[model samples]
Target: MSRSQRKQEDPDLGVLSSRTLFSLQRELFTKLGEQGHPDLRPRHGAVLAYLDVAGSRATDLATQSGQHKQVIGTLVDELVALGYVERQPDPADRRAKLIVPTEKGLDHMAKSDAILAEMEAEHAKAVGEEAYAEFKRVFRLVAARQAGS
Candidate 1:
């Protein structure tokens, strides 16, 4: 079958474009793995992306990432075992602990930032800067709308 025919068969990809989003995420994770964070998975990214520089409670991270507290707790445990995150007593609440990124987590985030920049450059080149910018603008708008909803 021709490429056009295949695309027509999956028109949702052209309109909704979730495939593109997932593909980009996979590419970024692949880049991260190649850069030395071999154990990191896309699931780990949910917690990492929402993590605050100061520190965040696992429950807060779960809410921010739209994940359950138990799932976040498990991921946080793995991250701690990997030396990417550490739990410390929360001064505000002695019964709770805050999840803080370790030096290793900071390093991974640094590499992720660089890789994302490179990916953006490549995407801009492939899709034209104007189109890429529009894509980002639309994504932000959609996200905002969803948040409002």
Candidate 2:
């Protein structure tokens, strides 16, 4: 069957889209592994992404990530073991510890950005550049609304 025919025959295009996205993420993580950036699971990557952007305390990360503190703590421990993040004393509260991404983590984030950029370029090539930009804008708006809900 033609590729388009197969896609049209699929009952759950949304599910297929989600699976495709998951596979793409796995492929990107595999590339990261080959580069010796530490083997990171999606949960670990989520925490790292959060730290890269917000530089929050563990409790804050747990809350923001909608993960239990113990679970988040375990992920943080793995990150620390991998040398991607470190627990530093929080300046605002000497009793609290802040989870901070290391240089390696920042480097990994840069690599992730490059990967995303490459994907974006592919999308722009497949769909017209203007369509790709519109797709991104609409996706971002929908995502923002979903997050609010």
Candidate 3:
């Protein structure tokens, strides 16, 4: 059978997931740009999304983001050049470094959180809060199962 024909017969979970992620990223970065963070990109989320407010190790960010350590290091370098994050001595482990957010990074985080909250609220409103909650629960289950986690 042809690829398109097979696609029509099967569930499009992968395609749907990709489309949803891309849409969210597009909306998110557009708003971020308008809010004074034009330099931010979707790739930056690999670090920003997993980064803790206090600070995080590059290895931790890599693990949390499911990215290679080298990739995380490159992202960290870009973030450092952009003035969003800085490397500071880790107090817990003197030999390790912590990726801490700067004032600008904090502002970006706050704005991103607010934007995502608004987007989720709109989704919940459109599909009824309880239904959206259930969708999330089921989606999480499916995602975890698929990931074998």
Reference-based lDDT, each prediction: 0.87, 0.78, 0.95
The residue pairs that clash in candidate 1, if any, are none
Please write out the lDDT profile of model 3 over residues 87-149, one tens digit for every residue.
999999999999999999999999999999999999999999999999999999998898785
Which one wins by TM-score: 2 or 3?
3
The candidate that achieves the highest TM-score relative to the unseen native structure:
3
Q: What stretches of model 1 exceed 4 Å from their correct place?
A: 1-10, 13-17
User: Model 2, 1-149: lDDT tens per residue?
Assistant: 98778767874646665886798778778877777664777778557656744367888887677788998899989989988888888889999988887888788878877876887798799999999899879877876776698
TM-score, candidate 3, is: 0.93
Model 1 root-mean-square deviation: 3.2
lDDT-based ranking = 3, 1, 2
Off by over 4 Å in 3: 5-11
TM-score of each predicted structure versus truth: 0.83, 0.77, 0.93
By lDDT, is 1 or 3 better? Answer: 3
Model 1 local distance difference test score: 0.87
- The predictions' CA RMSDs to the true structure, in order, are 3.2, 4.0, 1.7
Per-residue lDDT, model 1, residue 25, is 80
| Local accuracy of candidate 1 as per-residue lDDT tens digits, 63-111 | 8888999999999999999999999999999999999999989988888
